[model samples]
Target: MNALFFISQIIGTVSISAILILALAKLFSRRWRGQAEPARSRGYAVLVTGCDSGFGHHLARSLDLRGFVVFAGCLCPDGDGARSLTLQSSSNLKILKLDVTSDEDVQQAKKTVQENLPEKGLWAVVNNAGISHWAEIEWSTIEDFRSTVDVNLFGCIRTSIAFLPLVRASKGRMVYVSSVFAFFNCLNLGAYSVSKRGLEAFADCLRVEMASFGVKVSIIQPGNFCQATNILKLKTGSDIWEKLDSERRQIFSRQYIELATEYFLSTCRAGCEDAGPVVDAMLHAVTSARPKRRYLLVSAVDRVFFQLFPFLPTVLTDAVFSLSSMYATRTQMLHAK
Candidate 1:
């Protein structure tokens, strides 16, 4: 008993030390590594996708103000987001109607960008267009998974491939705006997580391949900013649940769906509202002479749960998720009663 007690005490001490080390690292980590020569924004062009809203829209305006000739790709060119961006910036900022999922639209966008590029060529391409859908793996259909991947994963790939020549011509950078979901998973986000995870892998390979070409590739992992992006507003758990078949609907009863939707909205409401930090990360990635390979802009909650939790044992992680699921289920049951 004494020996077992001593071993347990040693384990506790080691665990506590590890936690402290991680906390310190996170707290002290610099946003950008090394002092890079300042980037000349004039005459340099950057193409940013998904300017219709969210991170992309904010980033387009930010870069334009910083003197970059900005090509803002809006899925809805005449929409409020695109119009607002155009109204807010000078002629240096041009809005391009780009539907990343459509090949014809991507080609047209490429042509438009080429027509406007200075002799120095395009400086950077920020692949920020993506979509998210919320539904448990068991509840979601293959179509749901495909649609999510189409926008979140394939869209980045499409934009990057089309813009590579421009980026290479200027020896510029490619920045992919991924999510914290790329590194971690959560309930009702299976499709979204899978898509971002694939994007992370794609960025890894592209970074290695582009290294020899004097072009840099960076991935930005932003925390939950659903409010800022309007992602939760675009699609909710209830929206997905309503489309389910009667049999599936019975499995996740109406009461459960309502609770889940409420939970989803609450989480979104709690997410980061300001997109400034994330946009800053993107700017650094684009303009820095020596940008880091990856930037993580997650919140404290994300750091603790997704970042640190992964270092814990699998059983511990499972237990944490399982307990949360149990609580949610119990709450639903009570509500049903």
Candidate 2:
């Protein structure tokens, strides 16, 4: 009875403290400078990539509702998901098929966006296309890492170059959909972490370069969102697993793969990353009178996690990840670790 009472008291105290902090944040957020200020017009046109599903699709649709012309790019425009979005939206929504790695496809999309715009070019371009990875560093190859960086980081730069003319003409903005991993490395996420780390550097350089041209570049670092798709689906490492020795192949087992993939999805589903937060941030980046250089869409805890990670010693972080991978291996009942 005493223990229960003590637990309840702690919970009550924490709840009160949380409310107070939130109240203060609401008050102070108003005075925060550099961020896009409240309630701005959405008359400009915007382009977003990877709009078949998840964050890209959500942002494209949300911007369309705000009266902005949205040119949404998907891998398959004639597919069910793209067709569905196109059918539902009015003529203001345009869907284009683009694979960022393909120079031809990217060039074509560039031409289409330029042709479709009214006298004013785009108000903003959202680079939301990316892939995910969760594999041990040793088991994953340079090729695997390269593929991720190619799409997630280098591809972003390519898209920006293609759209620079339009953005400059309209004095628009660039929003890169980076991840919390941009500044932090989590267990078995080396491929993604390194790519995002590179992206963070690129975004910083991009801001300085574009600022002179009246272009604003803001990077959005969102935490794990529960949207349908995630990156554990990539297997640059998986395809050649059997070619390696038994010791290494064991580490890349079917069970190991599935567990790692599902774990990310499970944690994502636990949170209510309401589209509201992202949409709100998007509006600020695109429509605000003055936009910030970086918008972290992650929770306060995630921000803290990223901040603390760089200070941690390499041995400690590696040990923690080693144990985590071992735990995932243990869960593979069929393999019987």
Candidate 3:
């Protein structure tokens, strides 16, 4: 009994020592959470790309209201997305043009960083600029593949490398706006899925690589159908649309578009308000003493189901995809007609 008691005491001492060492380490480095940032600085200092539409613009505005100095960047400031953001005045908000695919734009952003934050590193850089091509592998051209990579993958690389030092210096965070499609597959979402999967890998690698440098990486996987501007204007009259004949278009209008549109619009409406959750997640990455490595919005239904579908028998998965394709095929026919 005495021996057992001694062993228990030793274990208790060891555990307590380990915890104290951690506390001391945190204190000595002065690297843990700094005091909450002042109202002027906002709660965080964030630079977000692709703010011309969708998540980026909404996120920027959302952060602004919460007292984060937001640098909203995009390719064009003329569109409705840009104009709406541009009209807003937040001394905390600064709108800039950043074409993620262009080296020149990337460099200019780098210079702007030195100019604005010569003394302090940015708290976060949100890489949100990306595009999608919803088509099967057979329909995807080499150029299509290259374009997708250029914008989604290569653009992330540029922004990360350019802004990595700031993240390291602030011991801040990098939020990669990945998609549920990264893990979930869709038949016609080939090019988009491929690129997003690469992004998921990138985030994983980045998190590990930057851990020691006082940097962390996080991913945001938002679910199905947030309404972004100009979706209705997608080149529906292009050659791609022509492939869907009149009979197929008629079939889709009767069968799927209504339900699909309703799903999309409803999700987006909820998502607009739910923006707070993701913004809260980003804030944790930016200011928390300990940050999470991954976050999923749990709203991406098709992609979520796709992730699980692979675990099912191949035949079952194939059957599910086949049914989903029928709607798209009919829509294609309508578009063509």
Candidate 4:
């Protein structure tokens, strides 16, 4: 009885302390946070990568409508998404053929923006181009790792370096669209988590380095919006199955692959359908006088999970993930049968 009472008391005290801390933080944030005036958004030039679809496409259109000169970089300038954007958007929006993987393309984009910029220079650069793949580490190929990292990590670095001069001149913000996976690794998303984690690290370093130059760096860590963004619409596990050797295939059967794939896809599709909150966070990062260092656009449940992650015991975390993986793949059942 005494132990139970002690535990209850501790839990109560901790909950109260957490609430107080949150209240204080909110109070300070509002008091110290810089407000973005409506007029400040007008005539600002913003560059957004991967505008062919997803967040980049939406952000470009939104920014243009807000009176910012938006340079939308599309991998396929003549693609359906780009064509639709051009037709639907105002004259302030320009679509550029930008493949973040290519240095030549990035350099050309920088030149184009330089010639088009007004006296204020480029107001912001939103690095939103990225790709994701789902596969177990053993099922993944070297090319898979390279392709995912190339687009998510190296791509951002290349674009940042090319446009740093313009952003510095304007003292504008550098906003990166990262993922919640950066905070914790998930099964079948090892490569993606690795890439986003690297991105978070780079953003942190750049933020500190650019502080003296009056350039602000912000990272937008959004939770699952895979359905709205169609981020995983093109991804599948068929390729992984086909590429595996005979022995590897025998070890992990086709049924296991199908089940695992279904689990991954279903989980993704079940996430938030509305992507407006993510875009809102991105806009705030770009337009606010003093943006947050990291914007977490996750649901309340996810917010709680993120907060508890640091305090959770490693063994507990590992056991939970391990059980999840087992449930998805059913490795033990496969072996038994």
**Candidate with the larger TM-score of 1 and 2:** 1
Encode model 1's per-residue lDDT on 1-337: one tens digit a residue. 9999999999999999999999788646633343456459988899999999999999999998989899999999999999999899999999999999999999999999899986567999999998888877877889989999998999989988888988887789999988888866777799999999999999999998997798889999888788788665355556777788888776777677677777777887888899998999999999887787888888665665666765888778667766786466845675663
What local lDDT score does residue 162 receive in model 2, on the 0 to 100 scale? 88
Candidate order by decreasing lDDT: 4, 1, 2, 3
Per-residue lDDT over 44-122 for candidate 4, one digit per residue giving the tens place of the 0 to 100 score: 7999998988888889989988889999999999999999999999998999999999999999999999999866779
Model 1 is weakest, by summed lDDT over 10 consecutive residues, at: 30-39
- Candidate 3, TM-score vs. the true structure? 0.69
TM-score of each: 0.83, 0.75, 0.69, 0.86
Q: Is candidate 2 or 4 superior in TM-score?
A: 4
Best by TM-score: 4
Better of 1 and 3 by lDDT: 1
lDDT of 3 at 152: 85
Q: Candidate 4: misplaced stretches above 4 Å?
A: 1-39, 233-238, 322-331
Q: Considering every candidate listed, which one attains the maximal lDDT?
A: 4
Worst 10 residues of 4 by lDDT: 34-43
- Please give the lDDT score at residue 73 for candidate 3: 86
